[model samples]
Target: MRAATKENNVRTCLACGAKSDKGALLRFAAAGTIIVPDWRGTLGGRAVYSCLTTDCVARFYTLKRFPEKFFKGTPAFAISQGEIHGWIKTQAEASLAHFLGLARKSGVLTLGQNTLADILENGGTAPTAVLLAADLADRTLREITGIVPVGTPVLRWGTKETIGASIGMRPVGVVALGRSPITDRIVHYCAIVNHFSQEH
Candidate 1:
């Protein structure tokens, strides 16, 4: 049997603006109090796809687009973004943990202050996203912001131990754009990070 490639299976996440192969993303439906994928895509309803990032899940919730899209014709109860985020977090953390295991083998993964600072100074670029443990949040948030160069949209995930453990990662800081309270924030963050990172 032959394998499918990106060209033939491209899918985009409307929520977080991430693109991937169709098989690489998960689809979710808005029903009752949450946005959830049928996994089989068998459950009938309007659908949205989310990439592996918990941030993407949070984006869907904050935007409040799931129930509106999924239950448009149904008589279901209104769903909250918070509920959707919670569900996504459950999945994302697990995905992140698997990803981390792979990263560990490649020697590209970093932890602690010196490693993170180098990431900040060098402009973080790794095949996998930066994952910090939750306990480091207060210190990492400030350091990340300092090194991240202003105007880079930082997506934050507030933590609980479950989400943290699932990813084998804790909440620290993210310096990327997926969703936004305001589009301009992402735009500005991107511009500033790029501009300053180049200058330094």
Candidate 2:
């Protein structure tokens, strides 16, 4: 459809002090005296937020004050910038791959260069979003961009080899995801990965 919009859960970034959607921010839940990461926001506890920008994430870890204001309580967060970044990055990637596997089982994933080319040239199931491998050929990218549905989010993700491995196939240059909870979560993890690195 269009760009993903914000909902009611707006949080201020602990690092940048900017207001943003919760899904776009990283959440850390309190556990005893440590601020444990709650990546998917699936935990129930006091929490704080930091937007997923490289600068914001860096600033967040360097905070001298624990920002009890944001968390609504004090927890001597036993975490480092490297830990947060690495943990979330690893989790986001593994989660994306896991969801891709689920998509395969659920029958909502489409891949293969020739198959995608044929589908784009002709007609078939409409994709909610399209993912092109990072090392995808420029010629194929040009062809696909010219044919991709307008307003559909197009992202460049893992290398052809990595992307293919995730879905149990040979090297794949492109993949189309259909609308479903699986796709939605894929998009969310994609956001986490992209925004976290910023340059990704």
Candidate 3:
């Protein structure tokens, strides 16, 4: 008898349709089970990797080619359509928080929201990304993005009912103090908050 070869866990890029090792791309798990692209490639769980950039992500979701593996039951089933989007938002926030926290510790970030907005308006400094609480209303990040829409923003997917009771829970942007690595912390926080919201 011949030994079984290792399963080819390598992923193919949805955009260029290029094949590469899993580590080369960002993976995300959608429909609660299937993996897609995490962009930052930091979020935990079963994920299918894809190359960075919105184009690749859009292709993966639009075609829904690989989703068959996880949606085999019930004939016409929808697992978690929002899972991939949620993961992306959470991961982005975590990455920003972590790095910003480090920068804050180093006394690099002296400006808060107002100052940051001012800088953005004046074309002085442009943030790489923005994280907003899902429940937050009257968001100003749009203006920042309009002036420089190239920046990405992470919006909260959980409601206040889920994370309202948590320590310093504010479903908007960074409340106070940045986390070690924004992506890691945001992902972890979203998981906990989402679990509670789903349970009770």
Candidate 4:
């Protein structure tokens, strides 16, 4: 949940034993005797990593010791895999919404189909990514998908109302984000949410 990148940001997954970028994994840190999530990496403690997949998340907790004994003592832990997963889902959802709002306030957002289509066609600031409402009409989805340039991420999440409300507007189905640090973070959260949704 940390900012998608930190220097020396590499961490090993406690369950899978595979090395990956720290931002790609869920992060946990011990708070005194209670373990807490470093959802933003600002929790300021020694941290552990776990893959986002349910199997890995569950496996991480069932290990012989918490985070394989990274801590000095086995603090009595009561958290379950399902609870952790719920926290992750909620955090990721909120993070995405937070970034989207930031994008709008920062003037990096293009809203609705007509505006987005015009920008794409007329060569306005090319979007780095696109977000389509989960309930976007099929015809609009197809049209937008075909128009978006290759390699640009097209994330499908939230409904028209949810997406529009995030930007403080009426119901809108499409949102285009220009290049920005916030956009990159949005992409990262989208991956977590999308991957978790698929697995569940």
Candidate 5:
């Protein structure tokens, strides 16, 4: 995949009014009479952008900003804030899942506790982040956490079986995400997931 050029890559968030790389913001597109989250940013319609952070997302909803920004002079659709929030949460989770699958296919994912631990210990190039199974054993979690270098984020996500299936392997407790386009996307979506979880 060729790198994205700079000209069409910057977008201003409708909520925050701050400029950021397009990929760093969530894109929403009109779907029929209602606005919906556009996770892949490929929807064929006018798109509104917002920062993925909870503050921006919350401001977008709490201040009732979407109607003015999305509808303009057109008659407003009867869209509920709850529905939009649900869509945002669903899309965030789906984005994370989709990138994990891609990372696996591209050979940028390391599976199993020992494999991830080896990467951490041998440390020439380190993974962008580590993923621990939500139900991972306390002993294994501590062992892996101890080995991971400072400043690298560790995310607890999914069960061992679910994560393993995503990577086409048998159930495994730990995985490491290496540097790649997919890794960047995974990190972004993970932040959205974490933010929403904390707020609710």
Candidate 6:
């Protein structure tokens, strides 16, 4: 499959009809009677896209576009907005977990604080981004942030235990996602999760 980041690829949001880079939009695939978030963009079926903003997500359901646009020819069914919100949250979390696991297996992710700090300090081949545990200590967080290269994205995601488990390690305070094919997807899903968190 082609990478979603191909420059020529663009998607139109079903909710607002805004055109955006395919990578900037969230994908949803028809699943029987319900529509589900397809953050990986791998699900096979009719797909709809939406921008990353919370307004776009809210508009998607507020405008009631899913059934008409994605489930044509089937009788319309009602689903609570709260239910859809929950599904999107679940999908975002699962997508994040999956991507982190893949990065670990592909050997593109570095776990532990010192290893990441060394990579940043050495400046040989720095990671594209840093993932810190949400509960990281203030002193440690400050130290890591001080060493991270400017313009590199730093994300506070998941608990220490959650991040550690994704990489088959014990609880870790931070991880560095190196330059790799999956890095873009990792960044995208992290944004989605952040958006969801801010919304609800």
Instruction: Rank all candidate structures by their TM-score, best first, as comma-separated numbers.
Output: 4, 5, 6, 2, 1, 3
lDDT of 2 by residue, 58-95 (tens): 77767766756435443456666566676777888998
* Residue 24 lDDT in candidate 2: 71
What lDDT does candidate 1 reach at residue 136? 48
**In terms of TM-score, how similar is model 2 to the real structure?**
0.75
Candidate 1 weakest lDDT stretch, 10 residues? 175-184
Tens-digit lDDT track for model 1 on 134-162? Answer: 44458666776566555544433324453
Error of 5 at 73 (Å): 3.8
Error of 1 at 152 (Å): 6.6
Error of 1 at 113 (Å): 1.1
Best by TM-score: 4
How many residue pairs of model 1 clash at the backbone?
A: 6
lDDT of 6 by residue, 67-131 (tens): 56567653332445666566666777887888898998999888888988776667768779999
Compute the lDDT for candidate 4.
Answer: 0.82
Cα RMSD of predicted structure 3: 10.6
> Per-residue CA lDDT of candidate 5, range 1-200, in tens?
88878957998887879999988888878777666667688988788888987678666655444555455544333346556556677778877878888999999888877877666677657778888888999999989888888889898777898777777788888888888888888887877777777745
**What is the TM-score of each predicted model, taking all chains together?**
0.40, 0.75, 0.35, 0.84, 0.83, 0.81
Better of 3 and 5 by lDDT: 5
Model 3 misplacement above 4 A: 1-12, 18-25, 29-47, 52-55, 62-79, 112-200
The TM-score of predicted model 3 comes to 0.35
Q: Going through the candidates in order, what is the number of backbone clashes in each?
A: 6, 0, 19, 0, 0, 0
Question: Residue-wise lDDT of candidate 3 within 1-200, one digit each (tens)?
Answer: 86644446467775568787664455665545344444555665545555644456556556535545434333211324445445555555454445544554554432335665666668764454444445545555454345434524443543443332232333333322233344344444444334423421
- RMSD (CA, Å), each prediction: 10.9, 5.0, 10.6, 3.5, 3.1, 3.4
